[model samples]
Target: MSISTDHTQLQRQLYLLGYSHALPSDGVVLVSTLLKDLQASLDRVKELEASTVRLEREERTTRLGHDKAKGELHALRTENNSLRAEVLGHSREADRLRRESRADQYRLSKVADDLRMANLQLKAESAELSRSLGDCQRRCEARLSELDPRGKIPRMTVNRPFDVSRLQTHKTQVQPAIVDLVDLSSRRISALEHEIEHLEDKLSTSGVELKAAQMEVKERDLELMRMNSEYERMNPAQDVGDSQVPRLTDQVDYLHERAEALEKEAKDQREQFAKEKEDLHRRWVAAENDRVAAGDASWWRQAV
Candidate 1:
């Protein structure tokens, strides 16, 4: 019989307890054909057993491949999550740096403004000092001109005739002190001017530094924006999802559950196939035993 017919017969025998119902119409067949058919059935069983083993191996390989893919995907997701965290951290750091830079710039600008106000105050004080010194010099010159007459021993004008000698002695003593006072005022004015100039130079330097700092801050802001743009492009999904470990862990858990469900389904299929194979094997063994017993009974009857 053909392999297909043998397989059909075996299936029928497994379900119906015997293959007599499916016997061919050739009544002249030898008893050897029955033995040969039994041998073919056994061979088919062996082939089925080999095929089962190959299928089990393939199932195991497929399971292993599934597990490997899951692990790789999990690792990739973990790395992506970590990269997102790193990018967020960098963004926070950039924000902090920007705030600090702004604060420093504000303080520097305030200092520069204060310095400018102080410079204006110094200029006003210097002008006031100059005016006061000029007034003192004029007062001293007027006093000396009233007290002494140049190239004359003493002046006895009609209005100061009685006070000429007293005036000469006082003028000689006070003139020197007035000259000292005028010299001190001049020196003070010079010192004040120098201090104002120094402050102006310092203010100029501070302005230059502030401008450089502002430029640096602008560059940093541009760089930060570029980094943010790139990060957004690289991981737009990360931005859409909540940036938390819990959420990522939940997603991982969901993936693991899906993988486990697939694995469970595969395992269940293997178990069901094994159960069916075992049932078929048992039926084949019982059928073989029944055939052998019938053959023995027939031989014993013939011997008698």
Candidate 2:
């Protein structure tokens, strides 16, 4: 038979045994002995039933707990999968940002290099213009010295006869060359100034871009930090569930031990009861034999 069926049969037998021991007896000692045996048997049966009930309750509770644990595990796994995907996405974004930042840095470095080259070119041009101006001034001084041998041209200007035609020709030729040299120098300076301004503007723009890049990096860092904080909050490695497993395991073990202990106690009580019942049965048999022997003696006397 199945275990449940056997248990049911045992329960029925125990009930029948209890009822049989409760039968009315004529002798007080017999009634008392039967009552005691019935009570003891009932007590043992009650203990066994109680153990069965407790074990059943524990088994039901364990099943419920196992189902709950499985549900929680499934939920955690789903959450872990989502978090892993988020982490991967964040990692990819971080990598992309790093690459962009590197590219920006390279561009900014190139702009700086261009600015440096422009400054160097401006310096060289300015130096060349200065040298040209000095050379032109020296040449003008040499021509003036050659034109006035005694260096008395200014002193004799008021006393000499006025040669307007010769003076006009000299003025026309010399003034144009000097004006041309000054114009050329001015144009060179203007071009250098324009180039310097352009370089300055580029440098300023580069600085702004760098600042923006830095700000972007900071924002990304903050975003990553927020994501990390969220991840930590959502996905705790240790929680109430972690402790609950061991606690539930301990409870199950305790229940098992209690059931085993109850079974052992029931077995010992049954053994003790069996010994007492055997002794009582032996005494009852001896009493019946003695009553029969006495009746037989009495009948024999009557017959004689």
Candidate 3:
């Protein structure tokens, strides 16, 4: 039974026995001490519970932040890979362009060599044609003088022989064609060079960007490692604290159980004491009744 109920029952019993207003000071002190101990235990349990809850909250928040940072790190890694692939592709394109430009330059060089040989051949052919024209011109003039005798036919002023105008015309036409070919080749070479320069610029810029991206990724990786290290540093202490909580709780529970057992033992002892007191009181009353009976018997005998 509860202390208050037990006290009330004890008081009623005492009132029935003509001791209505007295209480045992030792019993009151013992009950008060038990109550104080129980209150202290309850307070300790509340504090432990609050501490456990706060630790759990902090652990959950830390885990969430760590997970979020990991997710962002994953995204950065994916982007870094994509940029790396892009740089690789650009690098390959630049290589291909360089190969094409070299091939074009080789072809242009061969064409220029062929044009030089053709110009030499044209010069040699022109020299042979001029000699043949001079011979033909002398023969024609001798034959015309023999046929005309005196001075009937007029002498030619310019004796270029086999139509110099036609040869000049051929030379003019062929020179312009060769010059146009060279000009076209030069323009093509210039255009290719310009295109190569542009591609090189783009490639260089891509290289720079790729380097910057790599640097950023490296920095992020460093930061991530730092964060991980920091988390590692911090988590062990929290884990140690968390691990200790159960042990502390077990200790608390053991104390509470010990207290409860002690309280039960005290209650049982109190009940046993009350039972013994009642038995003693009954024995004393029985002895007094016997004594009164004996006295009445003697008086009766005397009266008789």
Candidate 4:
């Protein structure tokens, strides 16, 4: 019994020592698995740090782009302001030019009206001058008629002196002859003085008439010039009355030629009638001779 109890105690002691040794080996394996897990977590933290740095750089780039867009917008606004100021200045200049043009047009119209009035006054003066010239010409003609010598003077006649001398020898005839000679000489001197006065009056009248005629001619020339100018302004194709003048002249010439031809035909007809009458008279004479010969033969047979 004492030896069996000692063997059982030795077996319990060996079993307890084996269990302690197995517990220590399990603890070492658990520590090795924990170190491998810690190494994997450190690698993941390094990757996260690199991603944060990239995100910060992208945000700085976006801020620079925004500043550049603002600068360009400010430049465009300044250019638009300069263009608007130039347009306003041009509008003011255009309005000033329009006002000046209207004033010039009004002045030109006034000048034209003044010129028309002046022309009318000149025409009235010219017509008055023409009438005065016509009156002067008529007075001159009356004076010229009085001055002509052929109608005013008379001729003188003389008688023979032999009979007067014979009567003088017979007494009182001598005294009468002397008285008649003195009276004839006095009458001749008075007639000469009257003729000289008449001639002077006629010459003065003729000079006045000539001056009036010259003035009339000048006025007519001016009127013709004015008519010519008006005709040119109107753009006339031909002169007044010119076209019909030639036609009237042609008609006159035709009438003259036709009358000459008719006169020649009448003269020829008269000549032909005279020739026919002469031929009929010769035939009548021959027939009368034949009748007389037949009557003579019968008379002769009765006498035999």
Best by lDDT: 3
Please report, in order, the local distance difference test score of every candidate based on alpha carbons. 0.53, 0.54, 0.61, 0.46
The superposed Cα distance between candidate 4 and the true structure at residue 212, in angstroms, equals 74
| Tens-digit lDDT string for candidate 1 (202-255) | 555555655555565455445544543444444447563443444457457655
lDDT of 3 by residue, 96-194 (tens): 554455555555555565555555655645565675556566777888888988864544455444433355534333344543554576676677677
Q: Higher-TM-score candidate among 1 and 3?
A: 3
lDDT of 4 at 25: 35
Q: For model 4, what is the C-alpha lDDT against the true structure? A: 0.46
TM for every model, in the order presented, reads 0.40, 0.35, 0.48, 0.30
Q: For residues 53-84, what per-residue lDDT tens digits would candidate 2 score against the true structure?
A: 99999989877765665556545544544443
By TM-score, the candidates rank as 3, 1, 2, 4
Angstrom error of the Cα, residue 77, model 1: value is 2.7
lDDT per residue for candidate 4 within 1-304, as digits (tens), equals 7544443443444355463332233344353354456567777777777777877787677556544543443343334333333333333333334333333433344344444444443444334444444444555555655687456333222233233334333332334444344345445435544554554455455445545554554454355445434433443357435533443554465456546555754675565456546644654665477457646865785685
Evaluated with TM-score, which candidate comes out highest? 3
